[model samples]
Target: MTEVSRTRPTEIGLPGPTPRDMLRSMRFISREPLAFLGRMAAEHGDTVAFPIPGPPVLLVNDPADVQRVLRTGGRSWSKQTVQYAAFARVTGPGLLAADGPTWLAHRRVAAPAFHHERIEALGGLVGEAVDDAVAARLRTPAFASGDVADLAELCHHVGLDVVGRTLFSVDLTGQAAELLRTTGSAAELVVRQGRSLVSTLAWAPTPTNLRLLAARRRLARATAGLVAQRRDAVGPGAASYGDDLLGLLLDSDLTDEQVGDELVTMVIAGHETVASALSWTLMLLAEHPAAQDRLRAEVAAAGEVSFLRHREALPFTRAVVDEALRLFPPAWVVSRRAREDDHLAGRDVPAGTLAIISPWLVQRRAEDWPDPEAFDPGRFADGATQRPAYLPFGAGPRLCIGRELALAEMVVVLARLLGEFRVSLPPGYVRPAPETLAAVQPEGGMPLVVTRA
Candidate 1:
């Protein structure tokens, strides 16, 4: 009874863990989610149908199937799942959690700002913001005095600065600490909501939901201030609101509430997601000297950090980024609810079944990544990242619109930082445990020692 099986359930015709296994898994699911999910999939075959109270919850692990569910088309699969419904509590019906035709139209209007070429054009602005954030956030007296720095914290600050400058044309660094804290609190509450069927009544004045209410209120105010500030800066009757992403949104026909929702999405996604990626990449680099040296050397040889100009020249540095993303994808698990009866992975999934497609599982599959645990950048040296098993950004219609911007932002931050700072783990350093949040974040923060390279 303790052993997991690959055999299909006679009733449903799908393979999964038994009810007993589910009961025992609760002890570690909160702490070792990735390990737990990986083992369940490996033992139970591609789709592991977990027995949740309300509906059938399946972890879709097969690469082809994960893509298929995501690309299922029309209203067949939606963000009505627990995870996204919880996320929408904080983000409103923004791009991250929105669905249907209106979401499609919003995507079209916002797509141009995230285009590869447009992100490339923002490279200089990005580089400036990175330098400014590093100077202000990382070069503190503590770091100057030879104390180890919580580099993950600094990455959040820097990521916020760059996102604000390049996308919104605002200076959010002054408010970074408070804003980051508010967003972080909201993310934790959202995760809690996703895990429990009881928490789905978001309107209930339960303590957890009450705290989420506070966080969302603060976020709404912050978003309004951003919109109002942009209006004031551009002034009335100006020819344009300026060409930044925020400007495009402001010029669009989206209502005030719609604009606020989109801004909240960008603020959280842009800062928290990129910060998590940069933090993990730095942690990986600090552990691999040869790889770090090669990346730094590439930046040194190129004489520039702009991806627009040096993307072709810095293959290894970019590979380091790709490999790091492979190891620690920010948006780890994407969930969807079946809108109607449908077949999936050779099984009849009933309408409203909760299906989770995790990037963590897909990226770490041994079939796609040989020695999936190793931090080898050479796997991507060829610069081909269109692998089906890799959905660091979720697949199909809901694929992250900010993919180009996130990649460019990461390259700029890593290239510029490694260009000057020699980063390494301090003596007696222990790797932090990964926590599932808005991203796969280091439990505490990634602390590392750095000096001039």
Candidate 2:
């Protein structure tokens, strides 16, 4: 990970794992990130600092401190950490990976497409996508054959379809399989790169690198094709096409390559992330039948699950999605490179040090979350999903721009699906372990027994 830490900081000033523990941390992070992070916080408290030679590595597990690191750091903190480096291989310089002025510039061009009123208008669009998903995918003959359905795959298709209409103003069902495959492949490859840095060598022709390259090319091709088709249909040099992400980008000053990168970023961030959230929520609902039934009961009215209706309609369903995000939090861990010395949880962190804050850790802190390990949607029952220590979509300056869109999508999906199907875990089925790829998803996808509601 490249950072501006040109010089090493003197003296380790914070509580953390010993040198021996650091070595073991490497193994644990590769094997089980959540467990390793939990162990670290349990042993060293919220603001644990690693005694590394270069800069300093600190774990800011406290919620308030996590907020400070993300919100107050401003330009003092950069996203040039190891995590973003791996993700940038596939995302290029898109908004997710971009920083400082570049991020601001890209966000400016992209913001209009995701404006409040615009996303609010997405209710009908999201409804259409979910309606199609239910009819075309879930209501098929195979699902009726008593075979468990992989709702993760279905969620991906639902997410892609929603993105297609909302972002590109067209249906993406035909390309859903390829789009899902490439993005999923890229996410897995990113995890490989994160685990062992050698996978980062894209030119080496290593198996993971070769596959990653192919995935990137495929994603790039998909984005390019969509952008080209949209632009051509709109006629050359035309400023306005329609009210969508592609339309907004076509009017921006960004180059074609930059436009493609942004589109790919949105698809991955907007689709894969949302799919993971929905999948995890479904997994939780599957395990807790009462919650599932309650969600179904809440959304009994077809007119209740509108996009921006989160405040009014389907409150229990909203709480279910909120608690699911609190537990799974698709983007489990986010990192930052401190440009200068800073403080988190009252501990001094040297400049260039990597600050790792996992929403999984902070949100799960028993202090903030009583009985943190339990799966309870009652935590957010008051129609309040935001508060201290909940960094699902993150906090402050770099909070996900698609936060509202993602929430809207997840609520619509949960409300509609629960209203139609009754899902339960297969008999004697082992709960799939959480696998951290592009997102923390159920290993092998979420397969559940589905029956009509």
Candidate 3:
């Protein structure tokens, strides 16, 4: 670990590390990214430099510094990192993978679908999806027998179904399982490739890469099929597009390939992150019975309709979601490559340098969060303090467009689930370690015993 210096450098300073240390850091980053970044921030202060080959890699943990890199200096940076390069294989030149004009154009076309009015109207769809999942679980012998259920798996199904219904006006519950597995495998491959020293491994015809290729092909075919179906439904003389995101993209100037990429990106982004957030929130609530009891009581009193109608009145429920996001942010790390020379928190950052801002580290900083490790929903009772520091969905022009929908899904699904069942971790069960694949997810599924409330 790099030691913290007593005097902060006024200009950009690279904490020179021996070649051995640089190799060790790379290994740590690849093997355990969360631990490596946490240790770096703890031992080397908010800003730490790694003497890696090519451009310097810096991890900025300071909230101000993170803001500078993500917002103020955003125009001077691009998503041209090796990490994003690996992501582009599966995501293509979609909004998540694209930068500059391409990103702006996609964002503009798809923006209206995620508007507050549209999202609010989709509440009923989200509610129906959650109810369907609950009904399916209740039909299973596991619920009747009182056997442990994997809430994480259940949430993924619900998330996928919700995303499908809301975005494409189609129910994907039938294909959710396959989609989840394929996307997971492809995303894990990308993460591995991103961390590898050899960038070509991502494109190599290795078994993993082959699987990723197959997954991409499958996803593209699935999306293209949906696009065709929607187009046919509209008829030749009818409007080219509907109000949905898929409709907007098809109606836009983007090519069919670009439309497919954006659809795939939305499916993966829309479902996975929300599912991860819901899973973690359940795990946290299960661990904290008192909070669970309060939430249950609140849900019972308010009812399902109120989750959307009277959202602001349910501060505690929202806080629980916020706190969970703080501890287990799905998009744990945001990576960017400097496009031009920039200064970050009084330090000079050279063009082409890789800058990483980890919400997991920033949110958990002791200075920003008191008793950072503890699950305290009260911290968010009054809403997020230090806005830049609490970047679960990110900040700036590139902030996640689907954040509102994600939050609404989590709150509604959690309310419906907790209102009906009492969730408890299985006895002698070990907590799953956090793993970064597409998003921060539990290593093993979150297995918990669920009983009717």
What TM-score would each prediction reach against the true structure? Answer: 0.94, 0.93, 0.94
lDDT of 2 at 374: 91
RMSD of 2: 4.2
Worst 10 residues of 3 by lDDT: 2-11
Off by over 4 Å in 1: 1-10, 53-55, 73-75, 138-142, 197-199
Clashing pairs in 1: none
lDDT of 3 by residue, 389-413 (tens): 7999888888899988888788899
lDDT of 2: 0.81
- Comparing candidate 2 with candidate 3, which one achieves the higher lDDT? 3
TM-score of 2: 0.93
Regarding lDDT, does 1 or 2 come out ahead? 1
What is every candidate's alpha-carbon RMSD to the true fold?
Answer: 2.2, 4.2, 2.5
Task: Tell me which residue pairs clash in candidate 2.
Answer: none
Tens digit per residue, CA lDDT, model 2, 191-267 = 77865422255577788778877888998899899888987898976758677888888788898899988988988
Global lDDT of each candidate: 0.83, 0.81, 0.83
